[model samples]
Target: MTATSVARGATTEAAARIMARADELGAISSRADALERTHLTPEHRVAADLVGAWMREAGLTVHEDAAGNVCGRIEGLRPGLPAVLLGSHIDTVPDAGRYDGPLGVLLAIEVARGVRAGALPFALEVVAFSDEEGTRFASALSGSRALAGSWVEDWWSFADADGVTLADAFTAYGLDPGRVADAARRPGSVLAYLEAHIEQGPHLEDADLPLAVVSSIAGARRFALTVTGHAGHAGGTPYERRRDALVGAAELVLEVERVGRSSGVVATVGQLQAFPGGVNVVPGRVELSLDLRAEDDASRDAAWDRIRTAAERIAAARSLRFDAAETYRADAVACAPWLQDAVRTGAQGAGVADPPVLWSRAGHDAMVVAGLAPVGMLFVRNGNGGVSHSPDEIVTEADVAVALDAFAATVAQLARRLEPGDTSTAATDEDRAPEAGA
Candidate 1:
């Protein structure tokens, strides 16, 4: 058989493997609501175990690190070549959609299956990050940050709304928090990272695209604001004399919304609390959490400044005490250009119609790895305008198959690039952009 014939055969077989794995894994019902029965709590350890089992089943060497991150290594023809890291978190927020994290993990397994069946030149590592949701703890991206050596000790000291520290939660899960440093990987160990995930938004669905190549992950800043004012009798105090914290809070909220709209940035006041519960009493205190995000750090910073200025002015005008405290911040991350090109080329080869280059407003574990290695992402369309993080999140079987084919083709291209004495050129920037659909 000719070389072209062999290549075609491998492509057909890999596509079949991807679809098969997607069907098998999608039927397993890893839904967050049903996790309780499987001993898979929202905790990190349970997720780690679940990923380890999948990795083992895929015939890879699997293990958990001190941070409880589960990693599976599939050896390649050459042992010394840099390994490609794939997979995402197995953990989820409360009542999250099943496909959010599991899709990436299962896709990695499918990638490994393809490589094993057909000859590949570089090693691959399937990773299930320890904690990406930060449901039990205040810190998000625990596993990926640890791997990047960015995990801070003070983060463990953080307490949830229930006052449970992250360290205590770790201990309850039979994992030692003191050994988190063990999860850190030496810089330059990983050659590249690839993640497959649901778009979790309306873009792809609205565009009617099957898949998308992610260009950048947006930066996020979270802040907690407190407004304090004198509490008095609602009936006795005149409107002018009353120092209403709620009123001040309302003004700040509206200002935040205005800033977001004017600047074209994303800002949200997701949680709010009022003090002095009484029908007739004026609220003495109010607290709210602000989530601000943008495609870059400077824009994120500007958003934060706008919120602070608005809050300060409102508090001063209303004669209230204002406090703005930052809780968390993540810088924007751009995917490696080479890897982005590979993804586009592979998608084109797999016959995906007009895959778009897009940006993710939400953060992923992939962002953490971007600092350490070349990282790229592929997004599958979610129905209903790609609304995710809810029970209604959905992905079609056909789209999953498309994503799998694209993933497999990209992996194959990367493997060939790593072959001994292979000087094959990479896909150029022009190739990374989306093509017009037929």
Candidate 2:
């Protein structure tokens, strides 16, 4: 076989293996009809075990941390040198796509497989964080926060939909809640973190690009709002006498979209409910969820203020009561410039001389890890108009092939930068850890 054809065949074979593995992991879901794996559940354990097996085959020492993060490591020049970490979460949202988390993880294992012992200046570690979606518990990034030494004690009291507290769930899953602190990595121990993930948006697909370098992860805040009004018989409630909560909430939802667009942020009301459902009675109370995200925290907070002001107006005009409580918040995280250069170099080696850069609106484990180490990300183009978190999420084998090659190249580029006496971007204060909440 000619050199070009042989190279093409190898890429195809590697890509096929990654695709096959994604299929296998996708089948181990908690739901019968769709994919639904959550933190510290039976399915999580099964998936972690399978991933650990793959890590072993890749020639790494593997273990499960106290927080239930599956980890594998191969030493570099020496046993205890500070290491470069590569990984993504394995948790999933309800009805999630297989590629969202699993693809990054499987690719990490593949990259490690290609790295021989003592190959770089720093050791290489791959972690499959146990939770990033917050699907089972009220809190997200449990595994990564633990790794970053940012574990919040309050999260232990957080519970799942079935009323199982995180502490109890840990016990049930064969982990000690107190020992979870051991999962934290000491500062200066991790050189940097790298992740490869699907874009989860249409940016790359619109540009017709197979890959891009991530600029930053957007800050996000979530809220639960309640609107209240008087309920009355449908026939008895005259148009002029009506105080409909649903109507008021519908208006507020439109206001959310309007303010979000004007402020250049993404606001979504994914869930809305009306109480006292009856054909003869009007809805008296409504509850809805608001997810707000922006490239910066200040912008996100400002957008929320505008949204709140709009809600107040709608409630007053409709003669209803509106109240909102912040449910969760995470500050935005910017990727390190040096790491971004490495990612770009990697993509350029994979054929794109000028890869596009995008800010991630979706959260990832890297967001939490940023608190501990310099972080960077590579985004693979998600097909079907970049649809994600659904069964329709699609990624072609060709894209995966390019992603693997680019990801491996990224590791190599970082290695070169880390070589002795290379001060161009060599671990400076610019790469200082972001705040824990970052």
Candidate 3:
């Protein structure tokens, strides 16, 4: 057989292994009926252990950090050289699909397995971040942030639905809160960070493309809004006399959608609750969540301004009081142009002459990693119209085969750029922007 045919056979074989490993991890969930492996939970440790074992099998030196992130490293041309970081989170959203995060990880291991000793200029490290979904906490990206050295002391106070503090969770998982910073990689220690994830949006599927080079990750801001008004008997209160908070909140929700559409942002009201529930009583208060995202911070914040103004008007007109508390905020992250080119070249090497570039509207662990090093992403097309965070999420073995080939090529492309006297690997001002999508 020709060399090209042999490579194709190998790619197909590795893709099959990745799919099988995804099934193994999928079976390790906190629930019997659904998938859930959150930060610092028992499931997280189990998943980390499994990934560590795979890394070891790939000839990597493995360890679990203080924050519970599983890391495996293979030396490059020489020991202790800066490394090219690969892989993705192992944790999942509640009821998440098997391929969303684990595919990238398993693929990274496959790439590491293919590397020959002393062939590259830098180390190869794969990380199975312990938490990216925040399924059991108020904030997400704990594992990546800890690795990026962006951990906030306040995060220790965050609690789960069971009222377990993040600090306590760390202790329960055999991690030390005092040593969390030890997970952080020192400045200049990483060459770049790359992640492969299933495209959570329909753009790739709609375009009929198997992969794309991600351009930027959207900035996101989340808020908890409370609308307050006087409660009264539903039967006794006339429409003219009613000061219904729920009604105001409903109007605000619709307004958010309208503003988001016009402002070119994505806004969602994922949760809403009415207080003092009674069958015969008007809702005195309503609490709702607002998630706003856009390609950049300025646009996202502009949309939020419009939404806040509209919300004020709705509250005033309805004789209700409105208040909004900012809960989570992430600035937009732009992928490095050179890294994008590397991904584009990688796709070309995989047989695509022109890989489309896309902006990601979803948040990802790569966004946090960008704080540490230049970051880029390769998006694998998702089947079922790009459904994710749900059981319906899918990726064909054909796509996985192509993704593996492209991913390995991207790393090879990086290695070439990192050769002696190759300044293309040098950081630029554009590298300051963060990147990737979930």
Candidate 4:
């Protein structure tokens, strides 16, 4: 298939709207020279203000919540009805690309603007979560977690690179850190969360499709691992006698890859360090960071189990000591089947029937929101082989057009499906239902 079908076929004024809005928001970064907005910063407040204004322009009542989330809402036909939440984060990683999180927020606003002409059964809420990148803190998804009623007071102590505590930053932002719990939404108040983001992977571009549906967002487990062994002179220590921690760690890294391949999970050893100042000296110790992810918790936990066993064996054979400390664990979440079908129907309605489906490996605010509401995502193909979280990240106008059209249709379709008062309760315990959820 040629790019002509999507790249040329999809050209709506809405694409131009999205493009212009993205550039405008992209310019509101923390750094004058680069995009680096983080949670509770001055730049973040500016971005939130801009998003709030756009939300109001989209015909919704807008405000910033206690946890600093930007929100705009168009109420349903009747009072006390559950809402359909459409959104993504507004924060960015350091020197990050403009599109990663903000595109979803902007597209969501555009979709709401498109459908404001009609009445829907469920309230439509557009949220620009304040902190998804965790750039200024250790815990990720702080905004969404607060919305999900999972806020932890301990996070207030989370310090940024500058040693400023989250509470201190919140105070600086004119928010009472103690009132952050007000950000949490009661369970069942939301029908679903729909996010439209760049694919951030190569599949959609490889298939020459402008848009795709997300199947599930991967659950991730992060660990800091250390391998300790005796230090000795590299030249004097015989290969048979040396107990090299770095060598043992290297072998375990391969084990991580091997288990991940066989288990169908994604395991990464992104950070590694070796001890000893001299290159000629044998490494005394080594530390590594392991990130393991899977679409289901069972598989992810299983992979971790096998990896632990392998690490133990490697250490035993090499006369090294092994230790691991888990730093983070976010459970996997699958889109509701009905919502998945809704996105597909929206794509089909937009003339891209049977588009490919992709699963997100990277974490997002959706992971936390999924605990409170069913979630669905629309993935627009990215240009330049899906490079993301960098200055190189990009999207084509044609793809944006397709995404805007499909996302708008998705709202209308979901309204029809949910009009019968059968709102949001289908997957209340999706976290535990691996087969059905995944």
TM-score of each: 0.84, 0.93, 0.94, 0.92
Write one digit per residue (lDDT tens) for candidate 4, span 185-221: 9877887889988888888878988889898988889
lDDT of 2 by residue, 1-438 (tens): 111211222277788999999999999999999999999889998999999999999899999999999999999877898999999988899999999989999989888887878767789999999988888886778888999998889988988888999999999999999899999999889999999999999999999999999989999999999999988899988989999999999999999999898998999999999888787888999999999999889999999999999899988998999999998788899898889998998888888778999999998888888888899999999988899999888988989989888888888887877775666654678775465362
Model 1 per-residue lDDT tens digits across residues 351-423: 8756899889888988877666768999888887687776567777677667777887788667656666667
Regarding lDDT, does 1 or 4 come out ahead? 4
Question: Candidate 3: where is the Cα deviation over 4 Å?
Answer: 1-10, 434-438
**Largest lDDT belongs to which candidate?**
2
lDDT of predicted model 3: 0.86
Candidate 4: lDDT of 97? Answer: 88
lDDT of each: 0.74, 0.88, 0.86, 0.83
Of 2 and 3, the candidate ahead on TM-score is 3
* Model 1 alpha-carbon drift over 4 Å, by segment: 1-50, 155-179, 422-438
Model 4, residue 267: C-alpha shift (Å): 0.9
- In angstroms, the error of model 2 at 398 is 1.0
| Candidate 3: tens digits of C-alpha lDDT, residues 308-344 | 9999999899899999999878899988888999889
Error of 1 at 371 (Å): 2.6
Distance (Å) between predicted and true CA of 428, model 3? 1.4
lDDT of 4: 0.83
Q: Say which prediction, candidate 3 or candidate 4, comes out ahead on lDDT.
A: 3
